[model samples]
Target: MKTERAKEILVQLLRIPSPSGREDRIALYIMDFLHRLDYDVHIESDGEIIDLVVNPEAELFYEVHMDTIEPRAEPFVRGNIVYGTGASDIKGGIAAILLMLEQLRKENKDLNVGIVFVSDEEKGGRGSALFMERYRPKMAIVLEPTDLEVHIAHAGNIEAYFEVDGKEAHGACPESGINAIEQTFEMLQKLKELEPFKVKGKYFDPHIGIQELICENPFYLIPGLCKGRLEARLLPEQEVEDVLDLIDPILDEYTIRHEYTEIWDGYELSEDEEIVQIAKKAMEATGLNEFGGMRSWTDAINFMYNGTKTIVFGPGNLDISHTKNERIDVRDVVKASEFLMYVNEIYGKS
Candidate 1:
């Protein structure tokens, strides 16, 4: 593949802003690059998914997220580091794959492989799922920056909405209107008291963290409704339905009309599987000295849940995915591209 130019493509992707639910522009840009290479390309309107099939005969499908959290004030770099929102999270990995696709074409090396650039991976996995159902690959690799290691397992996330209600009245009659904010505080406390939300596995966090809560009309006009978004990162073995059931009582006790929606779930690749062995062999061939599972959640879990063996391996440091100072190492880009070539070849031969 064209790994030598990995840095250039990766840098270009980092400059784009493709937040969740707003990935059309970036997806089209990648589509252009893939099309120039003469590869089969298509965009799934469901999530604006941009998919590539460089070698139609290829069996393995490589996937990466094409959306960034946001853009920085100004592009800046210093000493092998570039700071921006999407650098490490995934744009870095996307660039590497794009360059590799081009390189494969330039070198006349057809590994019969395909690539998928998915949208909204930062939020719900609906984008990836849309592509997966339509184009189910035999084996899959999620492009999540993991410091060059072969990480297999990932936690899943379930996002639910809670709508709290209250009596609305004139601002003058403060006592007449029941303050919904007060009820929110009470509900939150009980939700926390449910306590000890356990997740199986060694490094998984047992308790789910509250992501954010949106409260409206807290002042001036009477406040009638308040909504809070709760996020729970579940374990691989944890049943999402069970967690939703656990929250049932808490919902009932509260004097409000609540709405719960299951956002998504997580998954893992059994250590003894064929996919795991293939990834280990590829990493060894690429001179990568490390391998493991990532603590953070990734689309890898989604594939595993679908009964497809999956692995998470890509360029950049995942720690920087959502940070203001996010950046990826240039060397990782080239290395990951080269490795992707080898992995694709292995999968194609198998």
Candidate 2:
């Protein structure tokens, strides 16, 4: 695969808006590209799964997502970096995957490998979860922006919604009704006391924040309802039940009601695994030495939970992901493509 062609593919993928849950357009584009290569690609009925099979007997596979965070602007490259919404978050990884596939095709050697591109990773790992439920691969390499390092661990997240119900009364009679908005603020203050929940050895304690608060009513009357959304980032060793227990003491009052939603468990890989070993070898071969930590939720957790030894590896800096300034270094993409190709070769031998 030529460097210019790789860049062109990256730009095209970035131009397509594939926000979480809406990846049909980009999925179609990917299918078309793969079909033109005469590869055996199978897409699920709902179009969320794009499976490219290089060798049916192969137990090794690579995974990437088609969806990205909402876009802020069109993609454009200035010098060695490409700027856009999903550029760094993962279109770069996708581009590298495409190029690697092309290289493998040209070699025409027997390779027991495949690539699975799924949807809904940005929201929840529904696509990955579904794939794992149906297909059983011995090991997988999940592509996410990791600046070309091998990410052996990732954190999970838990989101909860809080509601406070209050009675409404005429403004003329001030004390007759409870101001739910004020009560909500008080509740927030209590929750804030658990700030920076980090301990020395144990997985960093969850970081909590109030994501949303809504309470609107006529000034002449006290609001009857107040709603708040709370979210926490939990380390791999942490569990949602543990987080819920920690916050239970603060909700003792009868005024506040809460429920947990969007719980993602975390995972970590032992360094001695074959996947990690091959990745480290690949990094050494590629002259790269920056290992990274994926401190947020990723589909890798789904793969690991389902019994597949999985590692997250890709290009770009994750700090810019989901931000308007999201971008990736073109050189990094090229280097990642080379590294991944080497991993594939090493994997085939193993």
Candidate 3:
């Protein structure tokens, strides 16, 4: 596709607001775009996901999530950079996939490939989980903002919530009450010492930290109730249950009530694997030679868990993804499209 046309599509996609459960508008837009290109497109999960079939029998699929977190900025272009919510998070990747399809159609290049535009990725990943229940491709590329690096390993994650209760005392009291907030902090410190946090890998190390903390009764008194949420990124070699087991004693010691809201195990692909080799070749062909692990959980975890060989790759910098300053270089989007097209060529032959 022409560079200007790709930029236009990127801008159009970024203008649409599709957050978590609300992805119908973007899904419809993509359906129409694929339909106009003479491809079989259909909505699944009550229009929460869109499936575009270039070849139904194809064993390879390209996947992108349609939902972003929440819009922090409107779409705009300054020079070659496009700034907007979801611009770097995923819309940029979406544009590259669309451009690749358009260019393939224009060139009349018949290749065995399919596409999935999923929703709820920013929230619970229900869209991808639902898709995996029905289809398992032989190989797949789940796109996210990776700055063109090929990721064979993706970090797993755990989101936990806990509540602690303590006795309240007046502001002038010396040691009459226990501070629940302080107790919460101590609990987290103990949990952070789990073996998973010490485990390191070639591409990524495990991370654990508190994301939210709140205390009840904000008067000039020791808080009686404290609630908090902590998130952790596990290495590929770690298991969610194993980490939890190590923290069970700590939680018990503090008498803290805890619940795990989300849990997903990490996964990795061998360097000699066919999908990895092909992706690396595609990156090299496009002048991108970096190989890194995805520090954030992605739809790739779902596909890989369901027995599909999957990797995460795309344009944009992940660091700025969810911020108001989210943006992407239009040139990077174009380069990603070119890389994907090359993958299609060589993958078809293999």
Candidate 4:
């Protein structure tokens, strides 16, 4: 695929607004693009997952998300970087994948490969989860912004809501009422006193933090209810239930209600795994390096949990994702596409 063609696809993808659940238009665009290549393609999960089957029996596949956190503005290029929402987060990777597919078509190369473009990755990875319910590939390459590195492992995460119940009373009669906000603080304090959860292969230990909070009450009345969203990053050896059990004592101290919104266990691939070795070789061949572990969760967890040896790789930096200034170097996109081509060639032979 030509560099200009990759940039053109990137621009088109960036212009579309696909935030989490709303990925129809972009999914349609991808379906159309793959369809034009005369590949057997279909939409699943109510158009949230686009499955392009170049070879149905292929054990090796690639996955990339079409969804972004939110659309910030129309994409534009400045010098070597393309700046806009989703540009660095994933559109650049998506573009690279499409360009690689085009190259395969142009050269009439028949290889065992499948492409999965899923929505809802940013929200809860529902699209990938839905795909994994039926199809299981032996290996997969999850395209996320990793600055052109071979990402072997990453921490998993769980999203949950913590609710505290307290008695409400007039502010003037302070002793008659219990404040839920105060109860929340007390719970956090107790939680902070425990040792942080750790695992050997993970990049970091288990971490728990509050993402959002809400307490409603009139000025004259004390709050009776408080709710906050909590996120916990987990390692492969760390179970969500185990972490909850650790915190259960503190929660039991108060009248707390906990609801888990999303949960994904972490995963790690051995350095000697055949897929990892192939990716490392591909990176070296493409003039890139095998970087360190990814510190955050991604859709890769979904694939790994489903019995696929999955690795995270792509262009740009994860830090630049989900920001107004999200961007990727055009050169990085081209390099990733070339690297992926090598991986396909080498892995296909094995």
Which candidate gets the maximum lDDT versus the true structure?
3
lDDT of 4 by residue, 216-249 (tens): 9867788999989877777766666777777667
* Better model by lDDT: candidate 3 vs candidate 4: 3
TM-score of 2: 0.86
Error of 2 at 154 (Å): 1.5
Q: Say which prediction, candidate 2 or candidate 4, comes out ahead on TM-score.
A: 4
- What's the true lDDT of residue 271 in model 1? 70
Model 3, poorest ten-residue lDDT window? 46-55
Tell me the deviation in Å of residue 344 in model 1. 1.8
Residue 226, candidate 1: C-alpha displacement in angstroms: 4.3
Question: In model 2, which regions exceed 4 Å deviation?
Answer: 1-3, 46-56, 107-110, 165-189, 192-196, 200-205, 217-225, 252-255
Candidate 4 to truth, TM: 0.87
Q: For each candidate, what TM-score against the reference?
A: 0.80, 0.86, 0.94, 0.87
Task: Report the C-alpha lDDT of model 1 over 1-350, residue by residue, as the tens digit.
Answer: 33336556766776677888777778778878877877777656552454333443344778888776656534456655656778788877887787777777778987566677777787777777877677666677888988898876676556667777877878788789876667777876776665436424654564554566665775675677777776676666667777777777876766466565654556666778777777877788889967666766677766766766788898888766676777877778888888888887777677
RMSD of 1: 4.0
Put down candidate 2 lDDT per residue, 143-201, tens digits, no spaces.
Answer: 89887777787777777788888789887765999888877777667765663354422
For model 2, give the 10-residue run with minimal summed lDDT. 195-204
Question: Which residue pairs collide, candidate 4?
Answer: none
**Model 1, position 349: C-alpha lDDT score:** 77
Worst 10 residues of 4 by lDDT: 46-55
Off by over 4 Å in 4: 1-3, 45-52, 106-108, 166-179, 197-202, 217-222
Clashes of each: 2, 0, 0, 0
